[model samples]
Target: MSGHSHWANIQHKKGAADNKRGKVFSKLARYIMIAAKNGGGDPAMNLPLRYAIEKARSVSMPKDNIERAVKKGCGENGGVTFDEIAYEGFGPGGSAIFVDILTDNRSRTNGEVRKIFEKGGGNMGGPGCTAHMFDRKGLLQVPALAVDEDALMELALEAGADDVERLGDLFEIRCDPTAFQAVRDALAKANLSTTMAEMTRLPKDPMDVDAEMGRKIIRLLEALDDHDDVQSVYTNAKVTEEMMGS
Candidate 1:
């Protein structure tokens, strides 16, 4: 697996822990609200909202909570409006970092994120500094046991996917941003369930970090992820199983 995929798998495992604490629900709701606000309340007409709803359902978020978030975004109920923001920076061992945020107060969110970076041995960089090193793409992961590799590859290629990679027990599918939903629908039609499907920033060149630096980078990432305004954190830092277990 690539460093990015490895870290993603680790986060997928940690998602269970986050759900137990109810943090995952909060984050998922925020995403749903934002998606609804941007693309309207109907999931059928709004691809992003449909994606957010699927993610929330996978985490077992209550239907009522999801409905409330969508209503709030549609202004059926008074709720704080969120603004999307992205922050780029460098972390321990010169690892490239990208943070996606949704917040009502940019000033406060910016200060808090900057403080987290400094406290965790990283320094925030100007916009586009680290972002230029990455490309945004639709990523989908299907369990290897779900279907035969050859069959899956043919299906994905026919669905307009760019590349498909075998990673241990999973197959990672990459696709153009505009074709993400179509590709996902095609996979579903093939009877293959996805483990994860999301738009993400993939780094062109990953930075390797020793165990010590890896641990520090993970800590920084966890802190950022825990913030209510922060949606996702992307980094190029590589971690070994030993480092993650530590």
Candidate 2:
């Protein structure tokens, strides 16, 4: 979690910017559709759908769009069926990269993803190449202004959270995947709101790189993220603001 929270914060700011371009809604729709496809249309009985809907609402995704996505997933409204894939790769300075994709056409998405990797000083690898370097966990990011640190820590701990730490202006609470919903429910009952909440892969160890190498990795990452088929991009690159600036 050393470098993850910082990167999550960066992504949060970047997502706000991306939202204006409608990219955020597209991504949210994909999440909702996939969640629905996997776990039925009712969010109440589907934790993934519940979380996906919550995230979509956080970004102000249209109610109609959400309903359409759910209908599409449930096959009530005809739409292209999406398949999820995780691609592994390496970026500058041996940084491990993981890409989560939801696509109707795997061949096209794979080709495009491979091309981006090649052009960005990286190369796609066989599945599980970099996946082994990460751990899947529940991450909840709460704003610093939302609650007292000591009190939040106690709440989270009592709720079965794995750990709670401050990441810049936010407090990041980590919990096991099994306890994610419970922890979230506890927070909600306490009237604590989260800035971001998701189940994500956390790198075991972040790779530190020089400014030039970090910049190259960042460019590769952003390029991968901009692809329409790409849902989420994770990397072990530990790049600082100064490194990004320089």
Relative to the true structure, candidate 1 reaches a TM of 0.95
RMSD of each: 1.5, 1.5
Q: Write the per-residue lDDT of candidate 1 for residues 1-246, one digit (tens) a residue.
A: 366556666666677679999998988888999999998999999989998999899888999999999998888789648999999898888889999999989999999999999998998999898998877888899999989999988999988998899988899998889889888999988888988888887777777877888998898888888898888888877765567655
Which pairs of residues have clashing backbones in candidate 2? none
lDDT of 2 by residue, 1-246 (tens): 567644555666677789899998998899899999999999999989998998888888889999999988887778548999999999877889999999989999999999999999999999899999887889998899989999999999998999999887889999889989889999999999888888887788877787899888888888998999888888877876665544
Stretches of model 2 off by over 4 angstroms after superposition: none
lDDT of each: 0.86, 0.86
Best by lDDT: 2
Q: Which ten residues in a row have the lowest lDDT in candidate 2?
A: 4-13
